[model samples]
Target: MEEIFAICDDITILRDGQWVDTRPLEGLTMDSIISMMVGRELTQRFPEKSNVPKETILEVQHLTALNQPSIQDVSFELKAGEILGVAGLVGSKRTDIVETIFGVRERSEGKILLNGKEMRNRDAHEAINNGFALVTEERRSTGIYGNLDITFNSLVANVEEYKTKSGLLSNKKMKSDTQWVIDSMSVKTPGHETAIGSLSGGNQQKVIIGRWLLTQPEILMLDEPTRGIDVGAKFEIYQLILELAKKNKGIIIISSEMPELLGITDRILVMSNGRAAGVVETKNTTQTEILELASRYL
Candidate 1:
């Protein structure tokens, strides 16, 4: 369905037996790989299985025989040091896919593998424990802790590691860590001891991102990561995302803006109707292709 594909990060493409070299692909997916990821064949077992059922594989096989998805066989992979953009118009289900992967939404029928290990559908805690983090689109309600101090909010995701020998939090170390994140992420704040509520929208978003980074995630899912922040702040956040990818952290970014994806990501995944509509390599994909994909939902 459009929901899933709309948020998918595109896979790298190979032509004439050589890898494309412009920007390394990020959070890329191959058709065969995606299908195989679900234990099915590329074409025969893929099409009709878009809205994957929770029952027997045989039933799924019967559906795939109908070729429901109907998209061509496409594939790509993301390289370290690059971003992968997932784009679509509203109602295309892009956010749904990202949320499901982050455990904010349930995944009733697919296997989620992180760093080659299968993931369990427990809760957001399990997702974080497996080194996955999401900076959701609704930042105010989802990512921030407005009433908490800078240090408290930044330490929320990774608090277990900061517990003292007596099981009490070490306020000193916590402050030190918060200070470090603020300095490193270039977050503008009166003080790391100040309330997150006192900061501007940009600063608040930075705190949320900082908190997720505290967990040292291997894969980061950012849905509309830079929506309302100012242009300068957006650039800074983009830089941070780039650095993480360069360090080999797989990043999946969902945004309404096409240029953001085309400008920063190595490839763009086009989602519509709860499934991937199409995928384009950043070097090969244009804003027009994105428009075409977004048009499907209309």
Candidate 2:
């Protein structure tokens, strides 16, 4: 329906010496005109993901290597405001799948698309730049910096955007944003200056989610977001996730808890080994299917 495009016109103001503009296009659309331009590179990117009238998610269609311990030749699509749950036991590759989507890990085959457009593989930074965010499972090690103050940690992911001078962050902006998230998420903290080491597990998890929300990603990858947190806090997180969906953010939640996934996801995906074992409608399927899908790891 919508046309996705990239601006790749390069007249090359500087020749070899590099004294002029050499930036590539941010978005390129492959139209009839564009097809006339190169048309040969189509084989390079394979099936492109920019702009189309389809309910498909630009499925990643690479087979799981025979040696790998997971499903093979699986594909699926996700839509805006949809909450998809990935349910599997530890080592089932659920986390690995989401991590690869967030660029924390690598994938040998398959493609990823946003709104039907092929996604660029530029690591986590590229994914974030293209409106994707990740809330890591290892929150303590990968998501948050325990040594920093709560306020600093909350805003560190977005400090550069609030820079006042030549790359120097504006502390005031950071403090205000951090405070906003704390209040919005109902985080229990002394203030922005509180050390992260002092917060409870639930509060700490809230901070991690808050950090990613500040990036304004359209699609959020959450890995074990509710793991090891209090029941009340878990409910709050579920509410937040639902709220995010209501706001039209595509969410991929990697959760080990079966009830939690049943309670939230629009659909469920089960991973085995490093493969997508199955994708089932939430209401039509039961936990039995989830168990069967995850059993491949056994």
- Over 157-190, each residue of candidate 2 has an lDDT whose tens digit, in order, gives 7766798777777777877898888988888887
Error of 1 at 284 (Å): 1.4
What's the CA error at residue 26 for candidate 2, in Å?
A: 65
Local distance difference test values of all predictions, in order? 0.66, 0.71
lDDT of 2 at 92: 75
True lDDT of residue 240, candidate 1: 79
Cα TM-score per model? 0.72, 0.75
Please give, for residues 101-192, the per-residue lDDT of candidate 1 as tens digits: 66766544555654345677358998899887888888888778788788888888898888889999887888888998898888777787
Q: Report the lDDT of model 1 for residue 203.
A: 73
Q: Give the CA lDDT, 0 to 100, for residue 108 in model 2.
A: 61
- Best-matching candidate per TM-score: 2
